[model samples]
Each structure stands twice: as structure tokens, then as C-alpha cells.
Target chain A: MQKQENLSKNQKIILDLIEKSSGPLKAYSILFNVKKQGIKAPLQVYRALDKLIEIGKIHKIESRNAFVACKNSNCQVSKATAFSICENCEDVTEVSNLKLSKYLSNFADKSGMKYNKYNLEFFGLCKNCKK
Target chain B: MQKQENLSKNQKIILDLIEKSSGPLKAYSILFNVKKQGIKAPLQVYRALDKLIEIGKIHKIESRNAFVACKNSNCQVSKATAFSICENCEDVTEVSNLKLSKYLSNFADKSGMKYNKYNLEFFGLCKNCKK
Candidate 1:
């Protein structure tokens, strides 16, 4: 887990916007939302996003090309992140199961290849969508 | 597993190109490679890719924004796809493990969210890169 300190102005602005959002925000959308706050360019937003992802303050929902604040308070680094995404509602929820994380952290394939970083995205209808 | 039959001309051409590649191929790159074969526009490649992915003939490496042929022969549908990616070398390998697939397919999070579809990508140094 990396410590969150000495963040740049743009990083802070972008992270604050992502953290405030209830759903994931794409890079372009983040740029659009932060334009009033002096963040004007797409490259600026992307740079801030790269930094935020590097420090584990935010995570990219790769499947959706969207970014979300790191909801897992226990891990500040992005080593074992998992999300449950709703197919119908498009809601993404980070799963904070210690047991599941532990199991995945130690998991290896039949070829004896061990991985230190893994991202798992599960898709299903949420309870509300299921009804 | 869905049967691979009655594929459109573009779908077959795109799938063939992906299957021939040693690494994942991005959509634009696929378009570039297949330009001579009458696939001119990006949308043409994207539509073929969407169809291929829908039928489980290819899998998208979301982290890389690339597509690769489905290397797991046991399953023709994209219900349980997993890949181990080398962070240093950028090589991706599909992992075919029955136990791992079964465990994940039946896994439920702490909040009782059961997912029927999952795509897991593991990142680490490969054997060559570790040397």
C-alpha cells in the first residue's frame, strides 16, 4: 500500500472529482467535469489519472474505460483489486472480501506461474436490476 | 460452448488475423493489418470484433485495449476467461484450468453477489523477464 501524500494540484482535483462521484467516470468525462477548475486539456487529465492510478488513489475499470476512487481502504496499492459490475444497471462495486483476496493472492495456474497483481471483474445483474 | 459456424466474411477475416498473431491485437492495428483485404474503416473492424467477442472467438484484454483469439479450446463462450500477462514483456497467456474456472464461476462475494461472467487478468514477470 502506498501512502497518499504530497499530491499535485491537478492530481488532487481529479481525485477529488472521482471520489465524489457515485459511479465510474471516464477520462474525457473527468476532464469535462474539472474544466471549470482550471484543468483544461485531456492530456492534463490523463496525466493526473496516471499518477492517481500509480499511487492507488483511483482505479480504472478497464472493461468500461472508466475510473473510480479506490473504495478498498485496507489496500492503498492496486495489487488485488476485484469488482462486481452490474450488467443491467452498469454499477460497479468493489469487493472487499479478505478471504477472496487472500485466495487470489496465493493462486497460481497449472504452469506454476505466480502473479503478484490481478484484477478480476465479475458481471451480473444487481439486486435492484434482478427484480 | 457456442459452435463456430456461419461466420460473416469480415468476422472470419478478423478472427483469422487475431488467431495468427502471437500477441494481442488492438482494434486499429487489426484494421491496419486487414486494410488490403477490403476491411477499410475502423467501424468495420470494430463490428467484426464485437461479433467475434460475442461468439467467444476472441477475448479482449481490457487492460491493454487489445484483442486476442480465445486460446482456451475447452470453452467456446466467454463465460470464464482468464489470462496471465507479463508486466515487463507485455506477453499475455491464456490460462486453462478447470478447477480455477469452476471456483470462480461459483464464487459469491460477501454481499452475496453471484456472477455468471468473469474475466481475470494476472500481472507478473514471466520466466524470460525474470531472468
Candidate 2:
């Protein structure tokens, strides 16, 4: 693969965490795991995570207070807002399917409401996490 | 409506709050509103809410720390787990479509994993919240 944007040591570690996770992961787990690699302090990881989220390099699983890599980096996923999560596998996947997004978009247009943010979630076992 | 289980005055007030809301509500907002109605202790409301959630009387919007009454009280919805939520109007909806439910179930069967609890969320403007 073409070399993705080079990241600092901290970012690289976080990226690896998302890449290797069985499913989506919460921030606390990231904080705990990063320390295993010798990164110190609570804020350093979150700061790096925040930056990762901002650049669309990663996505936050809003319901679980966790982060996951955007399955499709080129897709238009927004980190500042909300998205769906799979409960079983702990994998946070993007919910940008055209049908669902448009269904919700139509709802917003009719409501005439402006919110700084919003959330949508579906809780269930994932394709992998299910029993 | 067949009189559901009779509720204490505090519980009754909470039901009314859910009934009148334009969308789902977080626990803190319920506490504030209950207090406005003269329920003295904060614990009383949460205690009631906890039970409401336990007995499948109300659904928790995990992403937003909020609650909504089950639109279909008679449906087999579980209060112990997660479900989809609408971010726009704060409405919580169930994602029990047979196709999706089976999709997740098969994945879990293969993974051999179990979680005491899980989260599933979706974020977007509602049919009404989209301007």
C-alpha cells in the first residue's frame, strides 16, 4: 500500500490499535493499551485520538465512548457528529448507506431543527460478535 | 388503553413526560423535570427510570444517556441491551428488522464471544429534525 500519511509515534500506535481490534474500542481501552507501549499521561492519547478523529483517519464509536478506523477512508464520514455501532462485536462501522442517510436527511429537512450534533445507534451482536 | 401496571405518582409523572416529549430524553433532563413537578429526591426518579428500563417499559438511548417509551409495548424488546436511536428529534427507534437481526446473530454464533451488555447507535437529523 502507498505509505499513508506518516504519523508521530503516538498516532501510529493508536492506528495500530484500531487496525488490530476484534471490534470497535472505547477511549479508556486505548489509553490503557497505549501505556503498554510506553506512552504516558492520559491526555496524550486522547489528544492524539481527537486529531485522528478530526482528519477522518479514524472514527469515534459514539455510543461506547470508543474509536474505530473508518472502513473506507475515502468515504465522507464525519467524526464531529454521530453514527451507528454494532454491540456484539464491538465494531463501530459507518452508517453512511445511501438509503439510511437519505431517510434521516428527509426527517431533518421536515423538522426544521438545528442541532450542533445528533446520534443514531443500533445495538445488536455484530456479524462476528454474535453468539 | 388497557391500564398498564398502575404507576406511583412519581412514575406516573415520568410516563407523562415521555408521552409529551417531542423525542427521546436523557436521564438528567427527566430528573430536572421531575423536580420541577415536586419530586424531592434525585434518586427517586432514577430509581423509577431504572425499573422502567428493567421491565421493558422504557428504552434507554445509550448514545445520549436518554430514554424513550417503547412505541410498541407489546413487542419483545429487551431493556438490558442496546437499540437504534434518532439523533435529530431525539426519538429512539427499534431496529428489529428480521434481515438485520439474523445478520448479527450469525456473526456472534461464529465468534464465540459474549458481553454482559452492548451498545448500538446511529446519529443523524430525524425525519422532523432535518431542516
Candidate No. with top DockQ = 1
Off by over 4 Å in 2: A1-9, A79-109, A114-119, A126-131, B1-4, B8-10, B16-47, B53-61, B68-131
Docking class of 2: incorrect
Looking at model 1, the pairs that clash are: none
Candidate 1 lDDT, tens digit per residue, A22-76? 9999999999999999999999999999988888888889999999999977567
Winner by TM-score: 1
Candidate 2's residue-wise lDDT over B1-131, tens digit each? 75556777888898789878867887778888888788877688888887677667777766566788766647444523334445544565654444433433333322233423333344555556564
Give TM per candidate: 0.94, 0.57
Q: In model 1, how large is the Cα lDDT of residue B45?
A: 96
Instruction: Give TM-score values for chain A, per-prediction.
Output: 0.94, 0.71
Model 2 chain A: lowest-lDDT 10 consecutive positions: A107-116
Question: What DockQ does predicted model 2 obtain?
Answer: 0.19
Assess the local accuracy of residue B97 in candidate 2 as a C-alpha lDDT between 0 and 100: 45
User: Model 1, DockQ value?
Assistant: 0.69
Candidate 1 TM-score over all chains jointly: 0.94
